[model samples]
Target chain A: EDKVVQSPLSLVVHEGDTVTLNCSYEVTNFRSLLWYKQEKKAPTFLFMLTSSGIEKKSGRLSSILDKKELSSILNITATQTGDSAIYLCALFMEYGNKLVFGAGTILRVKS
Target chain B: NAGVTQTPKFRVLKTGQSMTLLCAQDMNHEYMYWYRQDPGMGLRLIHYSVGEGTTAKGEVPDGYNVSRLKKQNFLLGLESAAPSQTSVYFCASRRLRITNTGELFFGEGSRLTVL
Candidate 1:
């Protein structure tokens, strides 16, 4: 079974705090790892990691993939109230070009 | 520029009732997918289409059917609604040949309630 697992299903952080979210996948044809931030209605794209040891950064959010361990991590620095959202991790498979998703990490940032 | 659009932003149906949700993408992409988001389960794939006439089941497809008669439109049909089927349905589109950083674009989502 191809699946992805995210750690710390829910997390709480104070303003200016930094946190880390973890994702591990066991897929047959892993092509890329994608991160998305879902707020009220739709999920917004965050980052897509394909190469090991390479990091992708956007503002205060950064992510990196470790192909050897079949794991990935998302780091958020300077958390704010607006950063409270569900963070999703998914694996993109080469075959069928489909994505297998994790349950997601719920993040709550307090002011 | 309408990236991806889903019709009927919200709907309510009784058990055994049938309904259809429509999804359209103007980006001319080759892939479209239907997903359901529940409270604990993030997003589960219901069905997907690779092209205009090709459709396939995903992780969970027992209660749904889909068709892609046109390149820009994908329709999801619920032959018989069940209480467990109540969820927020999302429509997404992606390029056929994806790059390392290429990500999916999602619709605003349609909230469905089954009684």
Candidate 2:
């Protein structure tokens, strides 16, 4: 069965701390993976990774994919209280035009 | 553009009640989806449509139904609500093209409570 699993189901950190969230998948015909941040409501896109070895970054957030390991990691540097939210990992299979998601990691950045 | 919009941001129903959540997208996306989120279960796909007049079951499609009568609209119907079905439902849409990034645009989810 195709599934995505995230580690450290919940985390707590002080401001200015760095945290890494992990996502691993087991699916047939892998295509791409995406990261989303959910606050009080809907989730917003954060990054999309299609290839391995390369890193995608935006300000204090970065992510990398390792296709060989069938895993990905999202790193947040200098966390802030505003950064507290649920981080979600999603993968798209080459078939079915469906996006499978993992149970998100709840992040709490204390000030 | 309104992007993706879901109706009835919140609803409460008794067991065995029926209701429908409406999702409309203005981005001309070719694909639309409905997902439910429970406390610790994260988000699970309920149903999706690749194009107008088509619908398919996803990982968690039981107790729910869907319809896509138009290119921009997808509707999720609960034939008989149950306490276990109380959850936050999210609607998303994405364009279907090889060149596209395959990013899904989401709407503010609908919160449903079955008592």
Candidate 3:
């Protein structure tokens, strides 16, 4: 079965702290990896990583995929309370283009 | 652009009642999908459509039905609502030719409650 696992299901950090969330997956015919941030409603798209060693960044958030290791990491720098939310990582398969998501990492950034 | 839209943001249904959730996307995307999110659990795929008149089951398709009569619309139906079926449903769409870059745009979820 295709599976995605996220470490440290929940985390708490003070404002301005740097945090790293991890996501590992094992699936056949992997196409790409995507990260999303969910606050209260639907999840918003963050980044999509396909090639290994290439980092995708958006402001304070960045992510990279290591296909060989079958894992990815999302890093947030100088985090704020606004960054506190559930971060989700998903692996997209080639055949059906289906997404298998990890039980997201709930980040709590306190001021 | 309206991006993606879901009808009836919230609903409550009796154990045996039936209802349908509608999803529409204005991005003119060729691929559309339906998913359910439960507490503590990650989103799970229910059904998807590659284009108009085509539909396929995903990881969790049981107790649900879907229809894609048009390219911009996808609908999810529950014939008999059960407590287990209560979840937040999301609709997503993506471009067809961008296979390697699997970026999906999602709609505001519809929260369903079954009693």
Candidate 4:
């Protein structure tokens, strides 16, 4: 079965803290990995990583995939209260146009 | 542009009842998918359509049926709603051109509760 696991299901951190969320997956025909932030109703795209060791970044957020290890990490620098939300990692498989997602990491940044 | 829209944002149903959730995308995407979000399950793909008139089952597709008769719309139907079916349903669409990175645009989700 294709599976994805995320570490530290939930977390609480003070502002200015740097946080790292991890995701490991086991899926066939894995094409790329995507990170999303779910605040309320919908999850917004953050980054997409396709190559190993190649980091995808946007402002304070960044992610890199390690295909050799079958894992990926999302890093947030200088976390703020507004960063409190669920971070989701998903693998987009080559077939069926499907995306298998991990359980997600719920982060809470306190001011 | 309304990227992806799901109707009946919230609904409550009794066991044995039936419901259909509608998803429409105006991005002209060829790929549309249905997913259910549970407490610890993240998002499980229930069904997907690669194009108009083509539908396929996904990770967790057992009690759900889907239709993609139109290129811009996909419908997920629950034949017999059960407590196990209570979940937040999300619809996503993505444009796949060559070896794309798969950036999916999602809807605001439909919250369903089965009593």
Candidate 5:
């Protein structure tokens, strides 16, 4: 079975602080890693990391995949109250379209 | 574009009752999936379909069944509702041949409560 584990299940940070969420996985035939942000409804796509060492960024959020280490990290700099949400990481299998997701890290940013 | 849509945004069912959750995608995606989200655990796939007329069991397929009779519709059915089955269900779809990136577009989600 494929497994994905995330660190720091929950974290609380003040505004303007920087936070890093970690996700590590074990799977056969790795294809890509995806990050999502969930508030009240379904999760929204944040980034998709396919190549290792190459960083993908969107505004205050950025993510990088380390295939050799079998892990990925999502970084949020200059965080705001609007950044409070559950961050999810998922690993897609190579052959099939199956995605194994982590338990997710819940972030709370206070102003 | 209504990328993905789930019917009955909220539902309540008694123990032993049955219900079917409908999912539809207008993007003409070839892949459709059903997942359940719990409080601490992330979304777990209950079932999925790679294309029309084909369904596959996922990580946690027990107590749940799925059908993909059409190209754009996937239905998840609970034979007998249980309290443990109460959770938020999400439907997602994606194109397979276009990319290996695996970016799944999700629906608003359906909250199911079993009393």
Candidate 6:
């Protein structure tokens, strides 16, 4: 069965700290990996990583995918209280026809 | 722009009660999907439609029914509610030929509790 697993189901960090979240997947047809941030409402898209080695960045957040390892990592630098939320990792498989998600990593940034 | 909208943001029902969750998209996307989120379970696709008048099952599709009679609307129906069915339902949509990131636009979600 296709599966996506995220490590450290939950994390706590102080403001201005740096953190890394991990996601590993074992699936038949792996296409792309996506990250999302869910706060009080629905989830908002973060980054989509397709190629390995290359990193995608946005302000204080960045992510990279390693196809050889079948894993990905999301890094947050100079974290703030606003960064507190559930970071979700999803895999787009079956030619991008299906999206399978992991249990997600809950991040709490204390001020 | 009202990317995607779900009606009845919250609902509560007793066992065996029936109800339908509505999803609408204004982006004119050809692909739409319904998913449920639960504790320890990120998001599981219940049903999806590629276009108008078409539907397909996903990972967990049991006890759920879906219909896409029009291009802009998709509906999910639960014939008999169960406590196990209590979850937050989300609706999402994306274009047929995904461009750029191929990201999905999601609704605010509907919270359902089955007693």
Per-model TM-score versus the true fold: 0.97, 0.98, 0.97, 0.97, 0.97, 0.97
Q: Which digits, one per residue and each the tens of the lDDT, describe model 1 over residues A1-111?
A: 788999899999899999999999887477789999999978999999988999999999999999889899999999999999999999887776678889999999999
Question: Global lDDT for candidate 3?
Answer: 0.92
Q: Report, to 2 decimal places, the DockQ of model 6.
A: 0.72
B10-77: candidate 4 lDDT, tens digit per residue: 99999999999999999999999999999878999999998999999898899899999999999999
Give the per-residue lDDT digits (tens) of candidate 1, residues B1-115: 9999999899999999999999999999889999999887889999999899999999999999999999999999999999999999999998776354448899999999999
lDDT of 1: 0.92
Residue A81 of model 5: what lDDT? 97
Model 2 Cα lDDT, one tens digit per residue, B1-115: 7999999999999999999999999999999999999977788999999999999999999999999999999999999999999999999999989866568999999999999
Candidates by DockQ, descending order? 4, 5, 3, 2, 6, 1
lDDT of 4 by residue, A1-111 (tens): 788899989999999999999999876477889899999889999988888999988899989999889899999999999999999999888876788899999999999
Model 6, TM vs. native? 0.97
Give a tens-digit lDDT track for model 5, residues B1-115. 7789999999999999999999999999999999999988999999999999999999889999999999899999999999999999999998977666888999999999999
Cα lDDT tens digits for candidate 3, A1-111? 789999779999999999999999877477788999999988998998888999999999999988888899999999999999999999888878778888899999999
lDDT of 5 by residue, A1-93 (tens): 788999889999999999999999886477889999999898999999999999999999999999889899999999999999999999888
B6-113: candidate 6 lDDT, tens digit per residue: 999999999999999999999999999999999888999999998999999988899999999999999999999999999999999988764434577889999999
Pairs of residues at least 3 apart in sequence or in different chains that clash in candidate 4: none
The predicted structure with the larger DockQ, 2 or 4, is 4
Show the lowest summed lDDT stretch of 10 residues, model 4 chain A. Answer: A25-34
Q: Which of the CAPRI classes, incorrect, acceptable, medium or high, describes model 4?
A: high
Model 6: docking quality category: medium
The per-residue C-alpha lDDT of model 5 at residue A67 equals: 86
**What is the Å distance of residue A94 in model 3 from its true position?**
1.0
Q: CA shift at B59, candidate 4, in angstroms?
A: 1.2
**Leading candidate by lDDT:** 2
